[model samples]
Target: MNLSTSNQPQDSSIHILHDKESSHQELGSPSEDTDQQYHHDWKYALKHYFPHYTYQPIGTVQIEERPSWFYCVAYGIQHVLAMFSGVIVLPLILGYDSNTSLFFSGVSTLIFFIVTGGRVPSYLGCSGSFVSIILTISNYTSTSNSEMNTNTAAVQGAILVLSLAYAVVALVVIVFGCKWLEFFMPPIVTGSIITSIGLHLSFLSYDEATKSSFDTYMAIATASAIMLISVYAPTNALRRIALLLGTMTGYFIHAMCNLKGVGPSIDYSEIASNPWIRAPSVYFNLKFDSSSIGMVMPILIVLLAENLGHMKAIGSITHRPMLRYVGRAYLGDAMGCFVASLTGAVPFTTYAENIGVLSVTQVFSPLVILFAAVFAMLLGFFAKFSAIVKSIPQGVLGGVTIILYTLIAITGIRIWVVNKVDFNDTRNIFVGGLPVILATVMQTPLQVNNFQLDGIGAATFGSIILYQVLQGYDGLAMYRKSIKSAFNKNKPRETV
Candidate 1:
């Protein structure tokens, strides 16, 4: 239908036009009646922009739409299960309370939703990128959880500083746009970063799973179950819940073995003794030391690469243009991490695991993620629930994580494949390989001024700088031309 305006007060007639003919028409400057109509239209758009009520589900629900309340809750629970291990494991490893991690994850995800205007479909979880550096700076031996807590303040301080650094990077992206970031983190560099993250964490998977022969066997069973369910499930619905179902299957087996006194058994005493409700304490976990800053700030590179990759992946999946939201996504994630730091939680980033879930379900509803956030928040209030999460045997988590982390690495490779990055070009090879190697090298006990430059951070910085240096002015010009051509090709056409 057409929106039309005319000056005549009494004689002006309303006309209903066909869809092809209907167009907004302005006869003259808006009269009193026209002004009221315009105001109404404006209000309608604004109200719909941030919808509160559930919307009917489409073929594959859009980010702004929702399924039924029950469906939303079910999808939300699926997302929670998808990201649960990654969200809680970091804190468990670092000796921080898992309850705090769950609370902040929910809160940060809500913050991300508000900041992105509910456009980006992602779940904020504790970051794995920070693990190596936290281990180095805190001198953590992983021998005693108490010893890790003793250094929690120092690690938190580093994260706080890194969050500020991320904020700065976000500001730059906001001002300069994704093109600025693209200059350094071209597809090749980004792909390598993704691959390196998986490779870096691979060792942990082996260690955690192989603690004993039984644990190793259980890990294999868990991973295999997840793969099988996701790939060969009988129904689409079953595939969507594959991660949750697989994890539960593995857990059941572990529990069964425990009953027979064969494998590691979960201690139920912790859950039984824990209270039903407790507020998360906000400790001043800040300790400003220059050395810590040197170590932690470099992680900003890893976070940036990861956040950018997430935006790109979601954009591709939803078939929506995400160029406009890149800066806000970065800033939102940074703000989430900053808040988490203040509350004695680990650094937060958009969870790749949840994105994998979205890819499988093809459900892009923000409400589903919002529901997950609410559930997570509720879980945080229950100390016993947090204990139950912690009670999942390490072997099971490792099995699942092996799959999750491997998928993360494959995602990077997929980016390269999708973008058709030219491996034939020697420069592309150097651009991708050098940083990853350097980062791997940094994994050792390498230090400068008592500050350890870990693999992820070192690789991130090394890739950016090395790529720029190696590519030089001539290479940059060609890259810019390519980007300009692609942008022009994708530019929308105006309708008459």
Candidate 2:
């Protein structure tokens, strides 16, 4: 009995009794360390900011060596199909040429994607959200500044200056504010703002899915199918491509149905007659007045907020930290918007349509999305190509857009939840409900100050103004001040 008591094991502090170094070798691999660092620096922030979700990196093309054109093309089509419906509409609504913007926007998107190192898998196109932003400012300046002779060029010039300024400030979100993004965008204000964005934008896709530029029901039916399938399907590559593939399929179905000829009319005549390669005009002239900056700055803030939400969403979807990737996206998005505004395309944003694409496909390669951007550019210059794509019946495109837009709305809700927003609070309730409801109302053809604030009517009240008023009276002002302190203790306090 005494001899048996000596056989007990003891905890090892340093030296192991057996050949345990092999176990350390197995567990302490360099790849594992790199992965852990990646997760901590980026992925951890993603979990802190976005919805609870997962992606398995579907459809990524290998970049260890140059990828083949076939791989690029296949990936590009999927990207294009995912993004096109929402992208092309920016031109259609704002009375610009869709083909022209698409061709160039496409090109700009690709270049930026490549420049950003293909870390995000999404395409760029004309952003419809800016239709209201541009037309609002243009119409405002046109009517009020009539004595000053401000043209669309002047309107665009003002926007360009605003975007450049925004880009500089946005960088501060990283240089200073990303970790405490909630300070300025406290869950309540951000959640409300996002909800307002979603509620306001809901009808955009619905309008596309439900009606045609020319009246037709079949087209809408086709579009709706695309939207619904993309939204409801299980997350996988096939689901990611759902709306895209469905839209193409709908186009085919429409073509077959129209064998005898009946759908909204499309005229390719202008495209056919267009020049092969004309350089777009740059640095349009300005006729800025004091009031115009006041009008534009609010919309710019809303847009920047929308874009910030998107980066957060993508980070959640990819399980990657936006801290590492979002600055580039903001840079690209602002640059893209500026480029678009210069060319008479409405400003653009990162679309929620790609959320479906990610859920369905599971692949997240920035390169694949960029390829689509390059293809979009080529399409932009080719009038015939633009005309052909634009010719898809409004109803069919609408059908696709309705679901995509709704999903976008849902995405906003998802973001709100991830941020742990307390919806029960009255501040959340007031700012949340009113603007969105009013925005939906004002998004129609409305006029104030001879200014067409259009989609932004919700953010207003009295001479105080739209959601812009929130910064002055709502919790956002307090949060922003706190953020400034957190960012710079020495920063002089400024009232909203």
Q: All candidates' lDDT scores?
A: 0.73, 0.54
The superposed Cα distance between candidate 2 and the true structure at residue 308, in angstroms, equals 2.1
Model 1, 145-198: lDDT tens digits are: 132355767777777877788888777666555675676678888888777776
lDDT of 2 by residue, 1-496 (tens): 2211435222121123122444546677565565555444344433323221223233442221224556556767677766665665445444455555666567567645643445555556544345455655556321100122234665666667777876776566545545454444444444554555556666655655444443346556565566566568665556666766676777776666577577644444555775766543233455665455555656655555666776666666655544444555666677776775566555655666665565555455555566677776666565555445555555565555555555545665676678876668555566566655666666664556645455553453311232235455654666666666657844322110
Distance (Å) between predicted and true CA of 219, model 2?
4.8
Give each prediction's root-mean-square deviation over alpha carbons: 7.1, 11.9
- Look at candidate 2 and tell me the lDDT of residue 286: 55
Best by lDDT: 1
Show how many residue pairs clash in every candidate, following the order shown. 0, 30
Window of ten residues with lowest summed lDDT in model 2: 140-149
User: Against the hidden reference, what TM-scores do the models get?
Assistant: 0.82, 0.67
TM-score of 2: 0.67
Per-residue error (Å), model 2, residue 30: 33
